[model samples]
Target: MVDHLIIFTRYPEPGRTKTRLIPALGPEGAADFQRQLTEHTLRQVRSLQQRRSLRVTWCFSGGDVAAMQGWLGSDWDYQPQAAGDLGDRLIAAMHNAFAAGATTVAFIGIDCPAIDAALLDQAFHVLEAADMVLGPADDGGYYLIGLCRPVPELFQGIDWGTAVVRQQTEAIAQSLQLSSHLLTPLNDIDRPEDLPLWDAVQRQMLSVIIPVLNEAGNIRPLMEALQQVPEIEVIVVDGGSQDGTAAIAQTLGARVLFTNSPRACQMNAGAAAAAGGILLFLHADTRLPHDFPTAVRQTLDGAHVVAGAFDLGIQGARWGLRWVEWGVKWRSHLCQMPYGDQALFLRAETFRSVGGFAELPLLEDMDMVRRLKRVGRVAIAPGRVSTSGRRWEKLGILRTTLLNQLILLAYHLGVSPNRLAAWYRDRNFSK
Candidate 1:
């Protein structure tokens, strides 16, 4: 017999969902928090489903079925929550699950980030002996509730959002002589004070995606440096490199993917294969600081920030390169436009929502930054990503700078990226 997992969540509508956090996170931020929390919880549930015979159902409020499906894809069951208070909805969901042939049913909310596959497995295992299972929240409410069969009286006449929720439920269970199992308590993201729980979870993983072309010399060193960083997934997308770049990256423990030329295509390919929640796009020649993961997380912690990049640090002794770094710093901070070499990072959801990087021959990073600015702040992290200054040194700093400006100006003046790419290639080849 298959068990059923019903997820309780609301469609993340600004000013509607997670209203308690709006004072601190603002409407958009609160909605985004809800979005992230729901997705995080689902990831855990999906993990459990992979190893067990569990059928998943999404019972949501505040948005229609189409909207929910559109936001989260249309693969699973999506049910609009029956209209009522929390207890009434819980009763209806439990009844529906039992009526539909569920051997055991468990209900969980989206607020708890600590509910992983292991915890969920324990909940189901406990239900085999106990009539009921409840995962308590540190706030005195329960994050999860499971039942072997329908027990409507367990949810009756209980205070839904108050501290006495779990207590009252357990008291009811005791009155009915139902044996209940309590899982470990976990903190939920309900108020401003509880936001740290989500932050801690988000800092656990960072996926660095590097796009390279024939940089066998640079790939090994970059991959080695990335290997030293904890809690990171390194993906090297080689653009048909002939200099053994892909082989070197594979040997150095980086997940290497082979894609066609053009940096945009390679980065997008890496992103598609990445499993982490946070994505960092780095140039093959750029080296991130040792604590880059912390820097990335801290910068993205801002309520209104959607994407971020590190400050540029060109590795060279040339005095002109210092000026180049200075200009890049001011532009990144003031204009909120950091080029790809500076190590751009953001939530994977945000990156996908912006349609990843446009597959253009040139100016794809600038286009991405401009599109991201329309959604939220494109922040610059305090730490710097040291990048090779070979381009400037090879073509003379002043000329290269002027050429970059000219290309940007032409791009804004309706120049096609293909033509711009051709002109840029010719200029670099002639130089």
Candidate 2:
């Protein structure tokens, strides 16, 4: 038996979709919110599909099939919403699903951030014994409605967008003596006051962006470790690696983006492609602590903290590395300057506000930290990210330390980034 899940959404055109949120989020922002919400909802649906036998249909308004496919990919069965009120459209979709031989059908809107795979699976499970299942929303409208069979009368005589939607639907079900199950109530994002619900959801989502060049050796392990963290999006931006780094990351289920070789350019590309509200800039060879997601959220939640990074832990037994770690701790806390190896992170909005990482070949991390400090405090998380010690081990620690300080001093002395980059490369190449 085919189980069908129908998702109702708009095309997210700036002035057309999520119009109620325009005053608070502006047209473009509201559209972006709609886009994110729809994508988030689909992610849960996809997760459910992985564990169950289900088919999905995308019922949309305000866009053509090509446009919808372009935005959301062509994997779904796209259907243009029938012309009528919300109730009419619901019935039409439900009728089509049953007509197409679906044994169980569920309809949902992309307004509830709390909807997840488990909740969705439970909805289908309830239909085994119950005639109908509805996920109640705090605003009195239901976020989800599922049925074992088509019940057209249930969609009739209800105020679609009012606070009485769920009440009326339940009353209809009671009058018909139908066996129905109501799931836990959740809040939906609709009004300006509802923005906080979406914001809270965003706080839990972290996008880890790794810029790489010929890093196939490190990409696999880094990706494997990252998969353990929940609610994180991994984006690997490859700077035209010849070692099949992009292919490896893609095979590991990480989104891969190809861009120019400059680290800043690659990082910026990943950020632009990211869908999460929080962005973490990571290195290919660095491994985050097990509790990195929690650490990231807690640190960013602090008052006056606009950006943050983890403490540096180099992977080696050298006693000198302890001194290096100690130096980093003080510099990060006192000077508020933690270099990129510590794994810098901040909100996506804050990153855009600061104009993203400067596209300099040398000292881009320092430049980014300096700019972030101007807006608010840079916090150092208690957790540490262990990075490879190849750089310090390849060159003597003392020589590398001195070279780094000299480059910093030269940057402060107003040396052109191009000149600094050339000099730095020359020094590294010189045995």
Candidate 3:
């Protein structure tokens, strides 16, 4: 049974379609924007991994099949929109799709950029459980409307282009006793006002750069650990480490940069000097778990993901240390707050846009991590970095956990940073 996707697109000619957007974008600009919108929509649809039973066809309207064809590329199958009102065109399209041996049919307009594999999956999921599914768009128009078993009565006599589009569909479905499911509402890229937020989100991926300081004790050990992986260049930002941290890192085949520190300052400076697709912030004392390169590659693979870190572990096997590892992983997964000790990875652009790490003496890692979560999926992978537990061992696990949780609570409650710092200062639990 062929599952069908009908993408409804009007001709992208000036004075033909999308009139309201013209006042802001002008005729030529509107046409260009529409072309981009159509292309983006097509690209997203094309990226849908080939489902064995699904076939996609484009339904073009406004009597410019050639223009639509040019925009969609020659590979896509297209049909000119059959006449009547908007309802008639859609009804005809759905019936045509059904005629083409499609047991299930879905249609989308050339708008929403947020449309992705996940939303399409949801649509199919709903079709499995219900007779029909309607994806309500933010602009009062339904972006996607699908039917598994046709109830023509469900589509008839409905108000089009009004806020009641979704509401009336539900009413009809209820009145006709047709099973229906509603997909989550998503914003459509209709107006220029929406561009900045989208652009900011797109810019959030940043490359990672690690700046090392006073690391003669840890540099070679960390470098050797990193060398087990391939294609990852560990850029070392050296803050005049007289202990030969820079030389050790260079000898281990890492790209090294000499600089001065106050820790955060050196990291931010290194970020400025380094070259990579995404920047990962690493502590000199921490060592990554196995397959670290693969983990980094996965996190940076897509545009939707902004930054990610792994679960954390320490080099030792104390019971308390294991408990800490479990606790950190649980909290990171539950809240998506993967902290720096685990390794803070970001797309290079996002890191620069956010102005790198705030030059704080303490909590810079946590603060950077918290800000990253706002942009995209801040995920924690199954992999982990085996960091040193000396801090916890010296302070005692109970005291360290209590103090960390207290600081975390205070931070979330918006306590003054100065006061928090003072509180941290007064308590001298060994570092």
lDDT by residue (tens digit), candidate 2, 187-254? 99999998888878886678899999999899999987875554567889998899999887876657
What TM-score does candidate 2 get on C-alpha atoms? 0.75
Model 1: lowest-lDDT 10 consecutive positions: 224-233
Judge candidate 1 at residue 143 and give its lDDT.
Answer: 93
Q: Which pairs clash (backbone N, Cα, C closer than 3 Å) in model 2? A: none
- Order by TM-score, highest first: 2, 1, 3
User: All models: lDDT?
Assistant: 0.86, 0.89, 0.72
Each prediction's TM-score against the native?
A: 0.57, 0.75, 0.49
TM-score of 1: 0.57
Each candidate structure's count of clashing pairs: 0, 0, 13
> How would you encode candidate 3's per-residue C-alpha lDDT over 16-101 as one tens digit per residue?
66667788778876776666556556545644633334687888876555654444545567889878777888888888888878
